[model samples]
Target: MVRFGVIGTNWITESFIAAGRKVKDFELTAVYSRKLEKAEEFASKHKAVHTFTDIEQMAKSKEIDAAYIASPNALHAEQAKILMQHGVHVLCEKPLASNVAEVKDLIETAKQHDVLLMEAMKSTFLPNFQEVKKHLGKIGTVRRYVAQLCQYSSRYDAYRQGTILNAFNPELSNGATMDIGIYCLYPLAALFGKPKEIKASGTLLESGVDGQATITLTYEEMEAVVYYSKITSSTLPSEIQGEDATIMIDHIGHFEDVKIQYHDSTEKIISGPQDNDHRMFYEIEEFVNLIQSGKRESSINTHELALTVAEIMEKARIQFGLIYPADRLQ
Candidate 1:
């Protein structure tokens, strides 16, 4: 069994632990939070054996073989580095880090410490995504790719009422590009590699964070347009248009249903390896395998992948004037 430590006690963290419960070999050893009450609450609810308010103290101990970080975006790199330094594998949530430099630093720390470090990009670890990669050539000579993930965030309603939650706060390194746009960007880059150039613009909110964003990535043979918004929802499915066929993605982030339309007008649909009730289970399963095998990195959520995603996000933010406090960190 892989003994695990959890950081942050939010909805996403709760969801992750709920999914982890589905894995037979997964064990929630402990949990940490700045507040003792919160830590106790989460630990009790998750059946974690221990709880602590000090992250450093928990990280330095040997109670956990791995830690799942679901903290604020600005804290991800630092938390992962600290845990890895003390001999624990880390599975951090998406966007990996605030910028490329932090992602590189985290990668170096994981390598130096010989500890596993993986970004919780649930989509990449899904069997449906892997299947899509194999059949990508079916849509021969790809010339265009488009991905859009837009959902009206539950927090947005509170934000408009002047609540100003962390989801729209720049200090916490939260924005549409980092929170939602990454779902579109990472999968596209995972399939095609980094683009030659990216031209992006975002609708900056009054708080100086992006409310909506549009990015156009130019490749050698294809031009991809990515659209993401936290203020609205999109009903249109994402697609890859090629010379021979077009591949339709029901949802890039969830990767629920995928379909291919050939030139002959026949359509084929593909689903996952199995019916997984919880989407987060796939990432947890991969994490356990990597830990048991003593692997230092994930093949799917590779160090290179995190760095590329970080670089793209940083550039896009710079283009849109959405700078965060983390960008100034060393």
Candidate 2:
């Protein structure tokens, strides 16, 4: 079995563990948190063999073959670096680092240590996303792509009551663009390479972070627009338009459903219902396969793709004036 360790005790971490169990060779061997009690509790709940209040201890223990990092955005690179330096593979959550510089650092660290490092972008690994990729030719020449993932944050009510949570905290690198926009941006970058130009506009909250943003990217012969928001919700489905047909994605974040509509008024469903609750299984499976195969990076969520997404986010943040503490450090 490929023994696994998990950092962070949040719902996402739990979800990853649950989904990861479905993989044939997956095992949750360790759990890490800043507090001993929290780590113990989480380890007990997940049935992890070891609990760690210190990440370095876990990294150095040789107890885990790989680690799934779902920590706060700002801590991703630092914690990943620690694990990689000690010869542990890492499956870091999306927006791999707070900025392009950190992504570059993580890439270099993984290279130096000869360890696996892959971004845990679950969407691209899903079957529906692959189907979308496979059927892109049916849509002919792509002309426009519009993706929007605007869900009101559960912590927004608390923020409105004069309480600031990590969801809106700039110090933690939490913002609409980083949190929600990446869902739209990653798929865009994966489908198409870097754009020729970018224009960003967003509404900044009082905490000096974006609440909602619309970014337009200009390519050689096509244009793409993405809308992301944490202060509001949108009912629109993301669509990619082409000369002969268009692909409509029901939920961009989950890639649960997809359909193609042709100019002749013909329609066909390209994707079926997915196990929404266990959507993370695909990425976990990929991570384990890579580790077992002795690969350093994933072809799907590649370092180049993560860097491209990070670079785009950095530019958008610069335009929005949404500066994180890590950005100041660089």
Candidate 3:
């Protein structure tokens, strides 16, 4: 059994634990929060065996074989580093760290400690995503790709009212690309590797964080257009256009419906959830498998993929004049 210690009692953390329970040999052993009351409360709700206000205490204990980190953007590296040092496997929430330097450091730390570390990129592990990869050749030589994820954030109205939450804060390394647009970049990188050229621009809010971004990446054989926005909602689906046919991804972030339309008047649809259905289950399954295999990283969520993502995101954010303290450290 992979006994788990959860960090952060937020909704995503709950989602992780809930989904993990459905897997065989999964156990919720501990929970850590900054407040003793909060940790205790979460433990009671989740039926965890223990609760600790100190993450160091929770991670160092033998109760949990792994730690699921759902903390804020800036805290991912620091918390994961400490846990890995104690030989605890870590399944950290996406956008693994605030910058490329931190991602490199964590990768090295996991290797040195001989423990598993995986990013919780749920979409990439889904069966639908696998199906997308399998049939890419059917569309003929890829020429152009467009991947978009845009949503009207529930917190945006509050930010507009001058209440800045962590979601829109530049110092915490949170913005459209970091929080939302990354869905496009990660999948693209996983499928096609790094682009030869990148050109990016953004619409910034009063607090110097990007509300929306448009990035164009040029590969050897194709160009990809990506749009990510938290300030507005998008009705258009993402597309991979080829000479003979086109593949349409209905939702880029958590895709449910992927469609192929051929020039010969034929259509095939590989179905997925139009919305979330056990979204975190796939990543949790991957994490558990990597830990059991004594591997330090996942083949699907490769360290190389994470490194490439950090590099591309940081470069694009810099181009938009969005600088965080982590960038300076890098």
Candidate 4:
């Protein structure tokens, strides 16, 4: 079994712990937080004996074979670099980095260190998504794709009153694209490589962050549109349109169940169990296997795809004049 250390004390960390319990090949070995008390609390709940307030210490320790970074967006690249350089495999939360340049830098660092590094894009690893691919040919020739991932932010009320939280803060490299749109981008890129051309626009909030955005990808024979929002909600399930059929994904980003409709016929494809524990299990299993087997490359091979999505995000930001300080790097 591969032992993993979890960084961050967020609620997401609890999900990771629960998912680890469900998977047989992996175990949560350590928990880290900036505060000793928070680390202790997480460790106590997860039955972890190792807890650290210092991330660097955890990265260098032998107690953990790898680190699962659940930290904020801006910190992802730097933290992942530290773990990789210290000989710890890293599975970081998605968007990978704030921009493509940072993603390239991290990729190069992983190559230099000969260590495994992958983004925790959980949606792509699930069986439901795999089934989507299996049925892609059944959907007939692809004509258009639309992915909508808009859920009103839990902190939107505070954000509206000028209390800027991380989710609504540009300084943290947070926005609709990084927060929700990447979900749309991932599956699109997975199904259809890079687009031929791209055009995007977003509504910038008062705090200079994107509250909502739409990305239009132009391909040779097809067009794809992605809609992501933190200021509103969407009822439209994400779907693919072809000449003969359409596949509908119930949830925008995560893996669950899918329904495919072709003409007047419909088929249901259910992937994961209806467990509320956490959606992090599948990706965690892949991370452990890669580390144990020394296959540093992700089975999904999404590093290049992450870079493509970052390029699209940068382009969208330019079109909307919604530039974050980190966007300055591009």
Q: What residue pairs are clashing in model 3?
A: 256-272
Residue 5 alpha-carbon offset, candidate 1, angstroms? 0.4
| lDDT of each candidate versus the true structure | 0.90, 0.93, 0.88, 0.84
Candidate scoring better on lDDT of 1 and 2? 2
Q: What value does the lDDT take at residue 65 in candidate 3? A: 96
Evaluate residue 167 in candidate 4 and report its C-alpha lDDT on the 0 to 100 scale: 90
Q: Residue by residue across 1-330, what tens digits does model 1's lDDT show? A: 999999999989988988998987999999999999999988898889899888789997789999999999989988888899999899999978888888989999988999999999898888888888989988889999999999999999999999999999998899899998999988888999999999999999998799999999999999999999999998889988999999899888877889898888999987655445688998899899988887777888888888898899999989989888888875
Best by TM-score: 2
Arrange candidates by lDDT, descending.
Answer: 2, 1, 3, 4
Query: What lDDT does candidate 4 reach at residue 327?
Result: 62
TM-score of each: 0.97, 0.99, 0.97, 0.94
Tens-digit lDDT track of model 4 for 1-330 = 788899887877778777878877787889988889988988998888899887789888889988888898988988899888888888888878888888999989989999888888888877788888888888788999999988999899998787999998888888888888889888898889889988988999888789999989999889999998999998778889989888888786765668778787866564556443466777877777777787878868457877777788777787888777776765
Could you give me the TM-score of model 1 versus the true structure? Answer: 0.97
Q: Global lDDT for candidate 1? A: 0.90
Candidate 2: which stretches are off by over 4 Å? none
Q: Write the per-residue lDDT of candidate 2 for residues 79-170, one digit (tens) a residue.
A: 99999999999999887999999999999999999999999889999899999999988898999999999999999999999999999998
How do the candidates rank by TM-score, highest first?
2, 1, 3, 4
